[model samples]
Target: MFDVAGLWHGFQIAATPVNLMWGLIGCALGTAVGVLPGLGPAATIALLLPISMKMGSPVTAIILMSGIFYGAMYGGSTTSILLKIPGEAASVVTCIDGYEMAKSGRAGAALGVAAIGSFIAGTIGLIGLTMMAPPLAEAALKFGPSEYFSLTVLGLLLATYLTGESALKGLTMAIVGLILGCMGLDPLSGAVRFDFGVADLQSNLDFVTLAMGLFGVGEILYSLEKSGTASILTTRIENVFPKLADLTRSGWSMVRGSVIGFLVGILPGGGAVLSSLISYAVEKKASKHPEEFGHGAIEGVAGPESANNAAASSSFIPLLTLGIPGNASTAMIFAALLIHGITPGPFLLKEHADVFWGVVASMYIGNVMLLILNLPLIGIWVQLLRVPYSFLAPLIMVLTLVGVYSVNNNVFDIWVMLVMGVFGYVARKLKFDLGPLLLAFVLGPIMERSLRQALLMSNGDGSVFFTRPISGSLMAIAIAFVLYNLWAARKKNRAARAVASSEAAK
Candidate 1:
């Protein structure tokens, strides 16, 4: 299923001057966003949706977008090492040992290990993607409406269980997202639903508008509340190359992180952030000197950094093959495809092989580009960190406003974005996980259409989902996950009550 000829052709497409220029731009912008605290790749991609779409070439646009995805994983470690600030959520663990290493005069070594590990891990993940995606897409071609419906159900359930601490809250958010997804014209009947006499609501609430509001403006508002002084280490970095001994010690850690990251990244909600956290824990558990963790251990920085980048690389699998966006960044990429009238699914490889292979090849090039940028351009990122958040925040707001307005040229969409921004701000303050919400929102219409079509085919029989072999297996798995989540939640609640009673007695 892996085609050498196709890969070579992809490289040819990716290596063109125009594609290379856009890819470089995306990598640079991604790195800058990663080095900045408030801006994220998801939000940046969402903000740039209009601009990328206007380029009129989906392959070039996706190559640029994919570069930003993995490039952020590399750039995130800079602030973690230098200032104890995580520029990206996935880099949070790096702040522990990375900052400690900086204080211990090993900042350059830490950064070096992180960059090298990321490159290696990204390569590993890319290899996995190259091998796995085509076969999976072939298999998915056999999926019918029942199978599709069941798969979406399984995805939503897994996302609810894996992405959030509270399954109830996650499910609640997912339900809300489903309702929102239904708030437009019915795809099959073209009958207006949930418009409530508002004309803008008839066509449908814009996904780009909602995404920009929730991620871009919402993050800015939240960051404003928590803005404070960042303590930058004055330690001068020297020798960015790791010692041979250190490399030997961290070699297995990077490999383990790569494997872990790639496997986990295939899961619906287990993205770069979750993969990095899991990798750090695994490294800590596997290390002989576990106590050295959080106190300048090189493995601490190596494993998580590698894992995050690997996860970023692998997360595109579902988006390309199954048309399922595994994380927010990929979800934005999914939106980009839709903007170009390209539906991402089983037939995408057959129809748009250029977009698929070109993006993958570009990722290979982008990973190398990031390694070079991170190693030699540390000072550039450090200088970027000095730009006041005050200035950056307002500038982001203006961009958000301008970008959202440019979408449909409707002032009503701007108001919708502001309302969603407030909702996102409140959701964050209340500790609600937004991942499931967004994922459900994206999957809702798909699920609805699949279910309706399945019912029509079955002549209104619901058992068709359980009667088919593939759909039956998927439905069974979804049921198992739901039961497991409920049982786990119950156990957790019981434990919390027991601890509370014991403390009260004491």
Candidate 2:
């Protein structure tokens, strides 16, 4: 069971002057990058990982990192509303309704609603974190490799489905990612695989290098190929708060989004991006005014904004409790913990309660800070957007290169990053989503290792996954999801055929 007293003690520690200062710095920096398109929290955290290790103790460092995570979630809404560009991937859905709202001169209301919704969602997610993480960790203590493997499978399926594209494309990208994950030395055997005789290849791919290139560089390439810049705002900005009617209309949407996002965020492959998309979809499906979705529906802005923030907060659960990186940003956080000589796992609550609870408590404080920071500074953010894209592009490119090279001091890593950038661009042009690719790449090695260990323990009995109670349930769920999708596809096709036949008869 979770101890509320322990979490309260954590707030006391996080409130210290130094930790609070670190939190403020992180929020400020995170907001700056997040308001700029293509710069995300993962790259920022990866860039700061080396610095965090040396800045202070692990507790203070993680407080800073967690601050950046939630801050980016809040800040991502800025460019989404004003420029119709997603400052982060999770903000993609926001661009639809948010930009529409801005076009109608309700940009401030959209921004205000996003901030308020995010604050509420973050608070809800934090309460869930305080109550749920410990119990989940305790339950996870009983899990073996088979159970972990099955859970990952289920997570991958759910992630693929929620991306709002054809599942076939998502699954294909995942297969490609799995192949990529097989690179580097065989952990169990002494032999190297897929090295192609290159000395640097023997070490396998660096997660940071791959993440930065595929997301950062790939985005730049894709965006550059598209002609035209974001529509610059020239109108006078006013009204920084939502009207009472706006609040009343979006209240339920916010509540539902918060709940859905937190649940999805607990799964291994889930994150803010998926949460936002699904929240937007649900709003469209359930709305009486469904036709208003892309034309500046407040439900569109409220649901996704709330969902992404909640999802961002809840995505930390698997990382803190199970020692698994739930998504890309958490993967970077996992790397940071390893740098600080702390292993996050089942014992995390028992052994490193301070670090665990302190980080959680700081999120509460950080969310408040983000609300305060974003509301008053909407004008500043809009003005910052006036800086030419030509100027920002070069600066971003230089920063990406410097951030990758600073930690490892390896030239090979630079080459790897560029190669991934090209690969990512090609894949995107082919209509493939990078979410599955990256998630699969990160989880592939873990899945392989888990299966091997489980087989070893079971002495080659392949049924171990099906025989185990928890693992079996998870595997069943995955199978059912596939079947359900197939059934739905057939039904949709049949409906199309019936409509065509009716037209011919007429």
lDDT of 2 by residue, 407-448 (tens): 578988888888988888888788887777777777787788
* Model 1, CA-based lDDT: 0.89
Q: Could you give candidate 1's per-residue lDDT for residues 1-506 as a string of tens digits?
A: 67888788899999999999999999988989898877889888988887886897999888888878788888899988998889888999999999999999999999999999999999999999988999999999999999999998988888877777778788898898888888888988899999989888998778889888898888889989977657677898777888998899999999999999998998888889889999999999999999999899999999999999889988988889999888878888998999998999888989999988898899988888888888887778878888889888888888889898898888998999899898988998887877787888889899999999999999999999999999999999999888887888789889999999999999
| Top candidate when judged by lDDT against the true structure | 1
**Where does model 1 exceed 4 Å of error?**
none
- In candidate 2, the residue pairs with backbone N, CA or C atoms under 3 Å apart (3 or more residues apart, or in different chains) clash, namely none
In terms of lDDT, the poorest run of 10 residues in model 1 is 226-235
User: What are the per-model numbers of colliding residue pairs?
Assistant: 0, 0
Residue 142 in candidate 2 has what lDDT?
96
